[model samples]
Target chain A: MAKHDKDATFVGDSRISAKRIPNIAPSYSEFPGKSEPFWPNFLLKEWMVAAVCLVGYLLLTVSHPSPLTDKANPNDTSFVPLPDWYFLFLYQMLKYPWASGDWVVFGTIIFPGVAFTALVLAPWLDAGKDRRPKKRPVATGIMLLSLIGIFYLTWAANDEHSRLHPSNGGHSAGGATAPAAPAEKADSSFKPDAVWTAQTSCQGCHGVNMEGVAGPNLQKVGSKLDANQIADIIKNGKGGMPPGMFQGSDDDLKKLAEYMASLK
Target chain B: MLQKMYDWVDERLNITPMWRDLADHEVPEHVNPAHHFSAFVYCFGGLTFFITVIQILSGMFLTMYYVPDIINAYESVKYLQNEVAFGVIVRGMHHWGASLVIVMMFLHTLRVFFTGAYKKPRELNWVVGMLIFFVMLGLGFTGYLLPWDNTAYFATKVGLEIANSVPVIGPYAKALLTGGDIVGAQTLSRFFAIHVFFLPGALLGLLGAHFVMIRAQGISGPL
Candidate 1:
């Protein structure tokens, strides 16, 4: 090993003085340093901290629960495309004026690529001798700016998301608005629209053409029950029918019920 | 008898000195645990590891009941949440653990950066840490689609579409990820494979490298 410089900082066992680098801050070697055995002391502290954190995590898991929604429906278009909260900043970045369509590369690539590269290269680029924030202007400035930018972008994205979907979380409630009722008189031989009534759902229990399988026969249902009674059953459900089975707007349900009433 | 057994193992394995060396390693006296951010640096790192373990265990539990098929994926998750005992809590832990790990990793990275710990011989460690960070994000993105809910389906569509916007190789990458131009059963399968296999494998490898470097270098001293 080369002879150590009395004035220089220790650069590992090779004794290569680190003070050779220019623009370096003065060494703190003048202040006497202290050291301790890593065994019992540090290990015990680390294990205690780990135990505490484990307990905290268990508590959190016990206290909080996950949210869930209905099954995946490909046909339903009301669902708004929202990424998880962690990615909301990037998601919002894509919504920028220059970030949409042709200029998307700038947002997704150029900007992020530059920032990431800068982060990876910061040690080399900002290797000032000082570790204090005040002494390292460029490093501190960059860190603060990036932090502020991320937070602002995240807030803006969340705000824009909330704004885009004023009523719901961008989810258009399937049956929120009532449909315009038909102006003409009730047709005695009315055959409910299969597509509108979602016949497959009804056929699951009602059998082919409402002849009844698990549910009562609806072939002459009109003679036994009024339209309002049938509508109640469809909405609230009865013995066999599950509530919310009729997946349609209010008008569709009312029309289907009326058509069933005319079956007799 | 216990001491004899320990001696026998130590004679062959030579574990005692190695452990003592690790225990006796000196950190700079200036490392003040009382400092707020300095403490958080360690706290968050520990939390990140804890959450990673929790995620792995909970995810394994979920897989016991979760059917990854298009028809049953959503239904299976519903059953797990509603029917299986402690399923909701386990799933919740996994869900929240993913988010917490990301947050902790981000904070740890920032702490290292601002503290100038990434300098000198530690640069390669920083690079490895970045690789692990990106892998963590990959884990999050892939795991998001496993539930196969409407939110998961559409978010994935948008995510893949963004991948499609990358100049030349974008479309191909998107196709590789989604298994087509759209998010469907194939996309779900791809995500499941990536989430459980690829990302975790890559993460463990990168993390091994990262910890090895950190251990060899010791914690960087306060500036």
Candidate 2:
């Protein structure tokens, strides 16, 4: 290293003169034409934009509010499941005839996988100096086509959902129903006991109102199986129902069994 | 008084120059809205990051009350929404913030692509950004199941089935995600741990790399 001049004023503890070395690159040295300070110059605008976003976010929260629906019931085959809006395009793609059954991978994996891989490799895929969309026709065209495809798929998904469940008022993605609305009961007068409410896991295979879905209708089960038989079946899984599905203690199981037997 | 305190800390830590370096840095004029109205497009990335910060803060508050089990998960969310003060607001912020962040990220990606910012020296940054995007999607997917609602259960069922549709590792991947033959307690626990811990950690690390790369490359030149 060359000896520093005795009178040279260094920056901090460095031997190099503070004025000798430029802090930024040559391209950035002349700030007036191409750049500005990041602090008050740029950050002030950022703060303002952030404030607007915050206000808009608050308004959206207050207006619609987040939704909370009924607790999960694995046995509820009647319920139509829908993913959030962002995933809606892919969800719709899986419904295509070619994408179903044996070709399911085309929609779920292959197509999406290819698209994502292309996106990851986009920098190299269209490695050219031209930045303007007009100059980069291929890249721009591909982007536009993809956007159109996604938008169309999303719209179709919403349309299909509405067609399936017209009463649902069309695609309630964000507007989920309120929590714990009592599921429709077969016999309105017959009230559900505490055991029934707590052990709702039974509703997974059995119907929400014990009217039967995948399982046999238990509304008149007492006429078919006695309490002991029902308890036996509950303890040891019967037919399609899996073993140890009922998670409560033996006493709760007995009560549930007895309750099932009395449903007639 | 504040200046004196800052001076004392700066003297001990030798931080003034560092602070000045950061606070007085120059950003390309094209990124400034005053330079051109089109420059507003650059705001999307910063907005995404801003919403992400809000998400982290609100998500922390949610964890205080959220229970990650089959039995209590739904009920706990209910209690928080109905009973806890400002709980609805916090939860709502997170809920809406998730959607907003994705929207902003998509817009940011579009802006970058249109401007050809992903070309050449900035290619690595683009890859890192895409990783961050996928992590954000992962976060959205995992967080969707946290409430343990009927919609969540069946939607997740559909998602897992899609995973299972893949040829070779499909079944195994589904089994790992489900944690068993079914999407029950184990699945809930797995998703909860992943949503709260694994993906967020990955997201932060990726985001840090993304920012450092952007700083190093000094934002791509104008179109």
Candidate 3:
């Protein structure tokens, strides 16, 4: 090793330490520097994650209570947009250039997949000269591009700058304004032509011709109950339903409920 | 009987004074824990610790009402939220924190890549990180299914179908994930087992090794 330094004396920067890899035995270890805890040395990494997982699980159970609905309510649409926060990234993704179907899914799902794939393949990809990042242009370029890609998609999903977040985190005076248009859209589902189109998603699951797969058949559901009961089943949700029946709008629930009743 | 066995083993062991009795050596000045790579590891690792801790605290409370079986899974979640103290917020924190973990892991991996940290000596560690990444993804998959809600049910079904779409190993992977066919009792059990036992167990060792390797190798600097 000392001899190499002597040989490289002719080269300009002798501090070209690629890495101090050992060339022996079947295996080796790669531990980093020994540092005390970031704080007063109380909790370590694993313990912290373990703690968070425990707490999060507790909270979720407390708020929603598992098995709250029965039988995975397919016909019921009473529930609202209560997606898991982890999914909000994608849920938010759905709003992205949503009019363009393929690009939307790509921005949300496929893009992340490709980026993670690249991360996995990084070792095989950039196997080149110097050790420091300063020496590696190609590798650096890829990382910057990836960061930009993620930022773009995330922004595209929830353009907080848009009407979505008018207050920049402050509560809107009424906040009623946010869901009005969407609510009206839901109400539009009740129109005769709209009823035919909207009920198909229900038909695909509950029964196209009137039966049940994951939900009860809706052949004569309207005669059995009034608007409110049907609305509860549609909006607040029922057994086996995903609570997607209505999203922050009674108008949508009315539309959905009326349509389901019309199925007979 | 166990106490006697312990005593017998202790008597046979010659290890008494331990490392403190042997010698003490001070670390070099440059070998601070906050070295570039060490700081780098600390950044993500510290975040993982924070997130996992939140998961643990929230999960314990959830278990109060979280029935592992399919029959009551949805109901229990509702009960916890409506009945348990601070249940909704805690659950939300856990959930939002999960998304945070995935994001942090991605950034950490990127840091490792651009810095050339996974070169010759650190190849295997990089592989371990990859495994960690996949395990996290699996965590998302199985955890989502546990809710048994519509989005969870349908999305997971989509995910399972995708898994099953693989030409040769599709069925096997699907079965392994679902524990059987659809998201029934068997599937729920399988996911719970993976989420609680298998993934955490695997991660413990991987995480330790990952940190130790980071310590041993020293962090790679900025690209």
Candidate 4:
């Protein structure tokens, strides 16, 4: 039994025997010399680059202006809602006529879903030994194709959104055609902040339906005061309510008050 | 004075060995700054960290005045844009910084992929990187809804509607995200919670892991 045990250990050792070693490639060692030290060599250089980026970002912030739109109005169906540019590719994909009918789920789910899953599994799938680009055609090709597809889809989505919602023309980065000629202007009765104000500020105290909770029922507020008086109460705050809880322009406050007075 | 201070700390912590260990990393000397692609990866990594700092700072400032309610959300943003001092610039920094950070991340991923850096020992790093990319995308989506403008509302509506189409657990997923069948106060609150707390928390933790992974397995060499 002791002799058998000795033989077994020897066999295990023989499997990883050093006798068949291959010559190490000279390029693996000779192609690149030793690295520099960390502090001044790497960290200082990184700091210098970060400083440049900081300056550049500061300049960008000083120059570019951010966009803001009218308050949210769920009832306004004319408002063409668009997402940030990063999501434009997916948005454009969803607009494909083939995907639009009953197969909308394919565009929204299967396409993105499959792409993400494939991306995660790519390294495992393409585990070729060679590292050279020419030797690794599959990985390089996929990367190039994905890059082109994403950019093209993003451009297409932005173009479509601009064509549809030309009222937002000024903010469209490069594509400049005239605003859509027939887009109807919203009239005076269109209070964009009506439901918004009621839900956000009033709903908490006046109940979800504005029938009153902690505060008096605003259901018949129009019968009690004029739009101007109501606007004053909103701007000044009343009873337990804090002052200027409705933080908007004076004009927005007036519109909201008008919206409230008209509710009854 | 600085040397003495270092000595004082080093006596207790033995940081001299740690510093030596960090500085003694074996790298391919051919990894020069003249290699624009590699330099870009390094520069953008730094820039991404810087931009995240900017985002956090600017976002905190915005949160101070910006109301997240359905009614006051848009109005608060408008007020920030028009009424407050330098509010437009702060907001603009965050907006443009978000775009730049996303673009940089894509470029960094491309650099890594083309160079075959995700092979062998570095596979886990690539997976972590992919996680970072998706998390950043989530951050963008959740943050988009906080303003509660028509664009934000409708865009989110479209997005949630897409979520509603998944084969199984579709409705449950939609309800989970929007907090109900419709986008309202509950939806706004939930999105705010995610944008400010959950996503950021996950991002910081993941970022720490990512940096440690890179430090463990130094930058991959050129092909």
Best-matching candidate per lDDT: 2
In order, the B-chain TM-scores come to 0.92, 0.95, 0.78, 0.90
Worst 10 residues of 3 chain B by lDDT: B20-29
Better candidate by lDDT, 1 or 3: 1
lDDT by residue for model 3 (B122-168), tens: 88789888887788777776777666665456556656665565446
lDDT for each residue of candidate 4 in B1-223, tens digit (9 for 90 to 100): 9978976655444566557555555445545453343455645666677788888899999898888788788888888988899988888888778877887788777777777778888888888888989999998998888878777788899888877887787788889988876899999999999999998998898888888888888888756
Candidate 2: segments with Cα more than 4 A from true spot: A1-34, A168-264
Model 2 chain A: lowest-lDDT 10 consecutive positions: A17-26
**lDDT digits (tens) for residues A1-264 of candidate 3:** 444543222224433223322222221123233433322232344345456655654564455322222335434343232233334354454455751255644644465667667677777777775767668877787788756755664455444423443312111221111312221112222324354345665554454444443455555567677666887766545654655533435676677677666644
- TM-scores of the candidates are 0.73, 0.78, 0.55, 0.72
Most accurate candidate by TM-score: 2
What are the lDDT figures for the candidates, one per model?
A: 0.72, 0.82, 0.56, 0.72
Per-residue error at A83 for model 3, in Å? 8.7
Q: Looking at model 1 chain A, which ten-residue stretch has the lowest summed lDDT?
A: A171-180
The DockQ-based CAPRI class assigned to model 3 is incorrect
**Candidate numbers sorted by DockQ from highest down:** 2, 1, 4, 3
lDDT of 1: 0.72
What does the lDDT read for residue A104 in candidate 2? 84
Write down the TM-score for model 1. 0.73
